[model samples]
Target: MASPRRRAAASPALAAFGRQFRRYRERAGLSQTRVAQRTGKTASFVSQIESGKKRCRREFVEIMDPELRAGGVLLGLYDDLNGDGQMGFPTWFDWPEIEIEADLLVTWQHTVVPGLLQIDGYARTFLSTDEAVLARLARQEILNRDVPAPTSLIALLSEHVLHHFVGSQKIMREQLEHVLAMSEVPHVTVQVVVNEDGMPAGNGGSFVLASMKDRSEVAYLETAVRGLTTDDPQDLAEIAHTLDKLRRNALPVGMSRSLIRKVMEEKWT
Candidate 1:
């Protein structure tokens, strides 16, 4: 069986820790202030961790576990959320709500079409199973949601991606057509980057940066080993700069559409 693809969200374990921590605090009859005082953290920090707005670090759990009389329960959950000195990102499955709630989503897809724009056939081609394809499709609804209005997307792709064959020629043709139709949507802009006799600057990998309505930002990067989601100011700034450079090298909107059509007609056909 194929290993499950990682979806960007607050990990269920992390959310559970938040819920359990809230219960332990309330049962002890202590306010967030009391917990913060005992842990040498701010009341806001206590609230955010308990509410799942922020990740509860191991040290925070170490201090709060004894202070809150949680026995080993809170520490255990923290360990489950983040095991041993490893990098902390794979376990977050909540709170940032990066994809679904973003007012604007900017994605760089070096290999294939962005998930939000992929047709079911093209998506399933590599996803290779119903369950995984469904997950990708579900994420796609984020771009078409009604309650908070549809998300605006700016997708930057490599010229190579348009010509790459994901499946059969028929599937490739349909996928390009789908991309073209989506590009016509009022809020979706698709640009292709073309550099002759050389690879583009971002060829090292593809990643996504989401700008939230609250003026905060988050970024997601998928590596061969794991997926990383971060809101760290400095890291986000670096990814933003990288994205800006790629956009600068990308073809204009009209030229990009023409390229897509040209490739679909000449190569896929």
Candidate 2:
């Protein structure tokens, strides 16, 4: 028999909640079939909920909380997912909540350094306002989480990012050094696509793909004035394929670091 297929999540928040629910269920030592039986649903339905392919209703949470001994933990997470917490974010973007729950992050940037890897001065140059700068810095918390669930980052940068001179010669130098330092982290990988590489994939703009612990993926696209986050399976698949192509075409990690060091010595000095 063929193995069952896995599905991507419908949204980042839903995927996060599903992960929490699954963890609690496992802690309670109950199977999806048993959970379904208790809630008047099928094992398939429970599977979908845990995979984030199906929504978990309030009624389901009510039934699950006591059974799983979650002590209202699941309900609290559900409320957070449903709340209006996007007021301070940029328009049409809901990535912050999703980013918090992602176990893997893949980013492709053609212009500036990816946000998570950017230094304070470099980030301030692009963010424009104090609040915006703080907000951008706030997102970096995921990279340094104290918990066991560390977020792994794979950042792909175009060769131009090192030479672009974001703030000043000094700031750029500091920023590049910061990138080098971040790459030393066990969970972070940095690669560069040299100008000669000639537009491998995702060359039009920048995007980030976040993978939840459950293996469901979501994607975010950003431009000069607009940003969008999507959980559509087809969109996520296409983005993933493009990212894979970019990864294959980019310089390997060691060589990329060498390239950065060479640029710093030649240009920044």
lDDT of all predictions, in order shown?
0.77, 0.80
Backbone collision tally, model 1? 7
**Global fold similarity of model 1 (TM-score):** 0.72
Candidate 1, residues 1-269, lDDT tens digits: the string is 22322343443334446778988889888899988888888999887776556786678878878777899887876775567553244453442356776778888888888888888889888786899999888887776777889888999998878977887899899999999999999989999987764646676577887766655566788678867776655776677677767877899999999999999999998
Looking at model 2, residue 182 earns an lDDT score of: 92
- What's the TM-score of every candidate structure? 0.72, 0.70
| After superposition, candidate 1 runs with Cα above 4 Å error | 1-90, 94-96, 196-199
The all-Cα superposition gives candidate 2 an RMSD in Å to the true structure of: 7.8
lDDT of 2 by residue, 144-229 (tens): 98885678999999888888978889888888898999999999999997656465577668999887777666778887788877
